[model samples]
Target: MRPGERAVLLGPGEIGEPTVDDWAAWSDTLPHEVVTGLGARLHRHLRPAATTTLRSL
Candidate 1:
């Protein structure tokens, strides 16, 4: 994705406890060039608004 492109994550309560092995596993399953952590606090703060804005954009 481009520099300004927006992304959101969905999972089964694993966002806060992500590890190196989690990333490595994601790398194999995701189609993107990279897969990185989105800390729980930031994810929680932005999830609602970000989803709306991203859809409109």
Candidate 2:
């Protein structure tokens, strides 16, 4: 991997939710920028005219 390169992973679909405290604890350990960036990038990639994701950025 190199700078500006992203690695995406797909998780299982049948997962259960955690308790409020557990969810809070887990979320506290994450990087907000990374989470939001991935979401924004995915949204761009899914746009109706997004034929080539390479330029989605």
Best by TM-score: 1
Candidates' C-alpha lDDT: 0.44, 0.40
Query: What are the TM-scores, per candidate, against the unseen true structure?
Result: 0.22, 0.20
Residue range 4-42, candidate 2, lDDT tens digits: 774333222124434333433566744443345445446
Q: What's the CA error at residue 20 for candidate 1, in Å?
A: 0.1
Of candidate 1, the 10-residue stretch with the lowest lDDT total is: 48-57
Compose the digit string of candidate 1's lDDT tens values, residues 25-49.
7677542323334444553422333
TM-score of 2: 0.20
Error of 2 at 21 (Å): 0.3
Error of 1 at 17 (Å): 2.0
